[model samples]
Target: MSLPDRKEAEVRRMLDVPHPAVPPDLAARAAERGRRILVRRRAVQAVAWALLLAAVAAFAVWAAVVEPWVVPPADTTPPLDGW
Candidate 1:
């Protein structure tokens, strides 16, 4: 037949096949692995947040001390034309 018919027949064959028996501890092992992955992800996120906060705090302290936004007034010496 055509490609669609062949694809339908293949899907039907796949559905007709019996599923394999799963191991009893498979769910428990998967749950444990998921917990570990979650813990690691949370820890990494926490570290990233802490580092970002530290950088912000340091920048704030530096800005407070330096006052980088303000410019100093210029001083000009008297003219020495009579010398």
Candidate 2:
């Protein structure tokens, strides 16, 4: 048989067998694990947001103090006027 037909027949043969018994506490365990994963993900997200805010605040403070956008004064003086 062709590869696709052979794969399909194999899948059908596997599906025909009886399935294994599931653990009684499977749902509870899954729910608890999911809750823990969700909590960890949320905690990480919160920390990331806090760090972003902190970085923004620091940049704001730096910009306020430094005023980097303003042009600097010329270093050399003009020639003496009315000499």
Candidate 3:
């Protein structure tokens, strides 16, 4: 047989072989690992949200104390004061 035919035969042989069975405990182990990862992710997200809320509160307090929304009066240099 030619090279192509030989490669096809090899691939067919490989495909015909049965795959190995999974270990009985593998599913349980995978579920436990997934839960651990999920917990860590949620904890990190919670911390990030708390920090954001803290920053917003601090800004609000500072704004209330400073009254930044009020506009300052215009300065005309005291007309005729130096005359």
Candidate 4:
């Protein structure tokens, strides 16, 4: 085949190939899926933040409300008579 004829044949073959048509609801379905994913992601983030906040609050409450240190009584040993 001549170069021009080969090129024409290639073009014709490409043009003749049928493209699959997208469904009418494809965009809507995709948008709905994306929204669901985003909602789930946001919910997870919110729960994580809530848990973290609760932990911090609990620690703060423990630190403020509970005095955990113990003080020893005064030492009773007598001073030495001579240095």
| Residue pairs whose backbone atoms clash in candidate 1 | none
Between prediction 1 and prediction 4, the one with superior lDDT is 1
Candidate 2 versus truth, CA RMSD in Å, comes to 2.1
Error of 3 at 22 (Å): 2.1
Alpha-carbon lDDT of model 4: 0.92
State each candidate's clash count: 0, 0, 0, 0
- Our tally of clashes for model 3 stands at 0
**lDDT ranking from best to worst?**
2, 1, 3, 4
Over the stretch 5-76, how does candidate 1's per-residue lDDT look in tens digits?
999999999999999999999999999999999999999999999999999999999999999999966687
- lDDT, candidate 2, 6-59, per-residue tens: 999999999999999999999999999999999999999999999999999999
- The residue pairs that clash in candidate 3, if any, are none
Indicate which candidate wins on TM-score: 2
Q: Please list the residue runs of candidate 1 whose C-alpha ends up more than 4 Å from where it truly belongs after superposition.
A: 73-83
Candidate 3: C-alpha lDDT: 0.96
**What would the per-residue lDDT of candidate 3 be over residues 1-83, giving only the tens digit for each residue?**
99999999999999999989989999999999999999999999999999999999999999999989999788766567656
Q: Write the per-residue lDDT of candidate 4 for residues 1-83, one digit (tens) a residue.
A: 99999999999999899978989999999999999999999999999999999999999899777755656667898788979
State each model's CA lDDT, in order.
0.97, 0.99, 0.96, 0.92
Residue pair clashes in candidate 4:
none
Give the better candidate number (1 or 3) by TM-score: 1
